[model samples]
Target: MRWWWQPRKQHGRIGRQVTALVVTTAVLLAGTWVGASRIPTRWFGPAHPASAQAALPVDRVVWAWAGAVTTTSATVVAEAVRPARRARLVLTADQAGVARSTAAVPVGGDGIVRLRATGLRPDTAYRYVVEVDAIADHARGDGRFRTMPSGPASFTVAVGSCARTGSSGAVFDAIRAVEPLLYVSAGDLHYGNPARDDVTVFGDLYRQTLTSPAQAALYRSVPVAYVWDDHDYGPNDADAAAPTRPAARAAYSAYVPHYPQPEPGGAVYQAFTIGRVRFVLTDNRSERTGTSLLGARQLAWLQRELVTAARGHAVVVWVNPDPWIAAPAGGADDWGGYPQERRVLADTIAAARIDNLVMISGDAHMVALDDGSHSGYSGAGYPGFPVLQAGALDRPGSVKGGPYSHGTFPGGGQFGTITITDSATSRVGVELTGRTWRSTILVSYRTTFPAPSTPPKPGTG
Candidate 1:
């Protein structure tokens, strides 16, 4: 008599549907437990005041000639209730405010401050000051940086990623030692999950590195540009489906503001040209749609940018969070996950016949040089472009997924420096170094790109 006991023509179908629903619910619950349990206990805990005299860890410096912007971001740890508010960031060029400013307010529990100084002269050295606002209960420090020359610029820009904030000191020291004109933090700036100290290990590790003598000396002398990857964004192999994506986005927002970026979510992936080289920065995260990695809009934007760059005699550098050729099968974390988008990008570049298309990325914990030929992907069709995967400045020894385990660095941390010399004959050189070891062990091809035949007027585009 009851519905449960009633038999009908569709009774079997209804029973199967109900069974499927129950199974799905159970599976979802199990997944939730797995995800929740994975979250480290340290992340949700309280904060502690760091040392007032603590040092600041500097990472990458970026120089943009076309926009007339030389930007730098540093990771600083100070002993205070509020490190961000207490810290002061200032940049001075020839005793002028070429680019000098203070750290933002309400420094988080991590004590990491992203500092940026903008509006500077081309090919010029500028002094910077970081101070603590005693009245504001803040700690501070000082540093210096140099901007790239306008035309036919001869400058060095260091590139690296996968730094854990633990051994970042060596990388900073290396950069300072080189005294590069600017630095480009390709991606994976932080280990991600700033709240989870153990899993990400950014807060403590960054604190240690910031206090390092070698690292402090460098922050006092260089500028930096930054981007985020899965580790730095929130969780390993994270994406739009991440349940805590909002929190991750918030953290990213906080982290990015410390640097001199155009605008948050306003294409963190942007294009900047220095000398004859044009950099096409891509934001694989943020604005990502569905399971696709780069999303439709970003892919379209990238295609347009690539086309524009190809039209001129400029070296086109494509910066992504993950290596394109490393994970050809789509790891849901790299370009492989978005096969359609990646194909579209590769196809577009190939179609354009962009000769100087160089791929720069981070995420793999070791230094690697791939000819852009991952399994499953047709490298033959893509014209055999070169993809250089810079090792992490930190977390060098950690294992990475995919068939490329052999390339992983055995050491704990590492970084790569890219130097470009633009002249009648433009040349680009890459130097892979160990942060803790302090040695330039690995080197890449020194290739020449087409030199710019005409110079464009400089101004904010």
Candidate 2:
């Protein structure tokens, strides 16, 4: 009987076909069983390897360009050993764990981690840590940063924008050579899109830009704050109506978690006081819709903040991703898009008699210094507040030239730095720093008062 069961040669062609069919069915069954059982185990097993640690020494430290005090945020591109594993971010005031706190989410593309530590004491030293996995492998490390002084203090703040991968890091080295107290990235941190599909690319680009040894060392030591222009947000000169808005928002949500920012949907805009100066940070990208320069609610909030600052001896600094005082209109990406609204803001400031107001912006990719003369406000129609437009750190050259030009320095690779000294004299001095491959330079400084000595009070003026 066993010999008969193994005897396949005795059968004809039909018998051979039947045998082949049986063999094929058996092979299929075996494959199905193995695949079903093995796949689940591999996916659910606890024995899998852990993810790798994120690359150390994150880059792009942007201090609050548009906020109250000198509050700031920093961003880093890190990776996990396993694709499914998540990275851990932490901020601390001291190494003793007494002042440790997690930072708020930042605003940018995905795969980027941000750690923001706020309510920091001015001019004080604080230690921080950026950990990968606290609960699992417990991977950890530390870094250090110092806050701006609460009173008259002399400290350098390195400011720039428009940096891309593959470029010489000499500019960053130049900025770090100054050993600035804080680092500010005005906007356009990266050129890659902030959409979902481009997140990995964005991360890669950011990683490449930060890989420089000089940039890493400075970031490890200094606190960074940032805002986003169109490129970093997605698309060149992108607006609120871009098709990738949702994807951009998701990326922004993911990237912002590594930084300290206010709650989402609740105005990323905020204000903080550092020394005698008040910094006002704005979210010109998120929650900004319509054809107007600023939505009604944000405008109202800005007016309120400005009014409050006018009553005190603090220097109120306003930062936006786009330049408001720069020339020839037609570009919906800036304040020029909404002339009515800009007029409203200018008139309000004039009516409130608010002094000590300074406006700084990026996104023009050129170093421009304007005093609001080209902003379309007549000398008699608006307050003569000094508005400064610092060119971009990446492309420090002008694109379109016109009659409203201030000083266009293209390919100059420049940024602006301001130094404030609060003394009994009640006058604030601001210095603008510009840099190039040749040397780091201090371009200019202007001194002004919160309230003019001979000016009438608000209600009586």
Per-candidate total of colliding backbone pairs: 35, 43
Cα lDDT tens digits for candidate 1, 1-461: 10111111112211111111012365455653422321111122101111123343332211111112432222322333343344545555785546546545554455444444445567666665444453422122544555555566656666677654433234455556666665677766655344342323443433443444444454445555566676665566656554545555444444332232344534356666665566667666655655567666776777887787766635667777676763545355566666777677766776777666777777765555544344224333756455666655644233333333113332323456556665555444432233323555543545566664566333222
Candidate 2 error regions (>4 Å): 1-122, 131-142, 166-168, 194-206, 212-214, 257-267, 287-290, 371-380, 399-406, 440-442, 450-461
Locate the minimum summed-lDDT window of 10 residues in model 1.
1-10
Which stretches of model 1 miss by more than 4 angstroms? Answer: 1-68, 71-119, 130-140, 192-216, 247-267, 288-290, 330-332, 371-382, 396-410, 425-436, 456-461
Worst 10 residues of 2 by lDDT: 1-10
lDDT by candidate, in order shown: 0.50, 0.50
Candidate 2 local lDDT, 169-264, one digit each (tens): 345556666777766666777666555445455555555544444444555566566667777766776656655556555545554322334545
TM-score of 1: 0.67
